[model samples]
Target chain A: MAVTRETLLAFLSKKTRADLSKIEDGAELFSSGVVDSFVMVDLMMWLEKQTGARLNPADVNLDNFDSVQRILAYAASRAR
Target chain B: MSGKPGIVVLGSPRSGTTLLRRLLDAHPNIACPPETYLLSAAARFLHADQFAAGLRIGVLDGLSFAGFEEAEVLARLRGLTFGFLRDYAERVGKPRWAEKTAFDAFHLAEIRRLCEGHVKFICIQRHGLDVAVSLRDLVDKTGGYVQELHDYVRRYPEPLEAMARAWIDTATAIAELADSSEDAISLRYEDLSADPAAQMQRVFEFLDEPWDDELVGRALAGTGQVGFGDWKTYARSSVDRSSVDRWRSLPEPVQVKLAQICNPTLERLGYARIESDDDEDDADAARRRYEFGLLLNRMKNEDS
Candidate 1:
């Protein structure tokens, strides 16, 4: 299954119990305290299960997980 | 303790001290432990608080009454604390030991005095605002039980401000330590993240220890020990520079506030000053987001 922006949003919303509407595509998640590191670890494992491959540490970082838009782009990049 | 410590790692919490400690600990000749709070606690014993002062005098007077000299009392204190460290180092098959605890940054002079010229200090620094960001994140993640940084966090109403103050005070103490101590060396966290191998080489050189390719590999893998240090470090398999400018993504008001609070120390430490708002376009956000996600995956793997 492909991970989309809405998929990531729904996950974050469920995990953080934050309003989905309040979470912006470009909003900082980990840095802004919307999502903490522990949730991030869970999300990363979920991403690996979805993508069907283990993530490379070199490829893993804040650049791919800080926002819904960025995460989708990361997913798209990994799909390629 | 069993042996005199040859190295002391000093830095503000979140300034990459844990990473450095893991690296130093991996070295064959050096055994760096997790935060022991021993040196800092010893420094506190020397504090001039009325109660502590009275206790020290009372103990010394009692010891004197028992024919124990002041020098002997001091020697006993050193033995009791440093012996454990020495034993740990020997148990780990390392010839020398190093200790790193964040609070020890505030007590460099006292630590040096107590170590009696047997210690060399390695002080690590990061841009104050970046440190402030992580510090705020830590307090949020842990729900205000950051004992490593408890002293600064409790004083301010705002987390960022409190974190900024911590960076400022710790950086200032490190700066003073570098200036006054011939045995002290300073390393920037930005530089370390930029090239950890080179930075570790520089550190090994400072300690007069041999640097090996295997040591860098071990350092990059990190110690899996769970303790009071940065939890994020446990997940890191390699150094990444994404966190170098993380403060740039902060809200403009927050950026300005932290910049104002930390600009002096930032300038002193040779980091750029954020005098006003800077643009962080969507592209920047995308880059940072991707980096964070990747770090998360690595962390997850380590967690499992």
Candidate 2:
């Protein structure tokens, strides 16, 4: 169940109106103005459901969920 | 007065003020500028000269002063600020003008002095913890550093408490100034969320405007272009009512520090002292606090 970049991108695409093509794997979501606080909750819920992983506030750091690639990586790590 | 009544919607950030502003703006007779912060910034300038330097560029159009009489400068500044608001309103094609600004809550005296008999104030209140959670969510979504968020909480302390204490403080302070002024009303975010139509009708009544059901309905339906885009994936299905006590959800040490810092104001606003097991009493005290506020308003009117 290793999450791939395409799967993460598709999930994000389905959830938001953002142009995912512009969202680079390493770009900062907040600095890039691609997301805001209200959307973060929805994203977390979607991720939890999709990957069957529970995320706590402490777990909500840049390493695991900064961008699509990072999210996929985080999900893959959890799956392993 | 040459036009419809001017309204000032005041609250702390993330207190549902923006949503309320949009709702009020939906009224055909009303127009609001986004977070003008004129009076608030002026207060900060009066207290701290350094802030004036930064604010002059963004808000004061590069205005300068080289040691003029403080009172005279403030008076002149007030006039300039009011002029800006009035002119903006005129340009917007609406006779009634409103401004939604957070810092304005901290500058009640200046607001009263400037607007005087001219403007009405709408105070919007949301639970402070909810606001903090919202702020946390915002910082996370925006990819702000956790360290920065921790720093802000450490600096502002009680002023940053999520429940409506700051809103209540500002409203109470303004209410004190607005005694017999006939130009201030307080609205709760919970009531509005529970029943928008009823709450809106009350808002219109308080503002002395005719209620338009259709306009209110449209505003409720219109989320605007906000909270869209990539962020939409992160939207919470609904705000967590229980999150109002999110300070409890923080690490024990963080919660202890926040409680210690916030206890005095929290007690002043009728929040229970945040011991480990004060949840039920805290909620009750919060409810009583708002009830006393309504009572205070009634008592003031009776005295008047």
| Candidate 1 positional error at A13, Å | 30
lDDT of all predictions: 0.75, 0.58
Clashes of 2: 13
- Error (Å) of candidate 2 at residue A55 is 27
Ten-residue region with minimum lDDT total, candidate 2 chain B: B227-236
Highest lDDT among the candidates is held by which one?
1
> For model 1, what is the error of residue A44's alpha carbon versus the real structure, in angstroms, after optimal superposition?
36
**lDDT (Cα, tens digit) per residue for candidate 2, span B197-288:** 78888888998788876875566555543432223312323322443455544533345555655565445544576664213225543454
Report how far residue B23 has shifted in candidate 1, in Å.
1.1
Q: B1-304 in candidate 1: lDDT tens per residue?
A: 3353468889987899988888888888888778888988877665443364455454555668899986787678777778778887888888898888866877766676677566788989998888888877877897865464676666887878888887888899888888788888899998887878899898888878888988868876765766667777867888767788888767554675677778888889888777763333256444544665566667456545
- Looking at model 1, residue B229 earns an lDDT score of 72
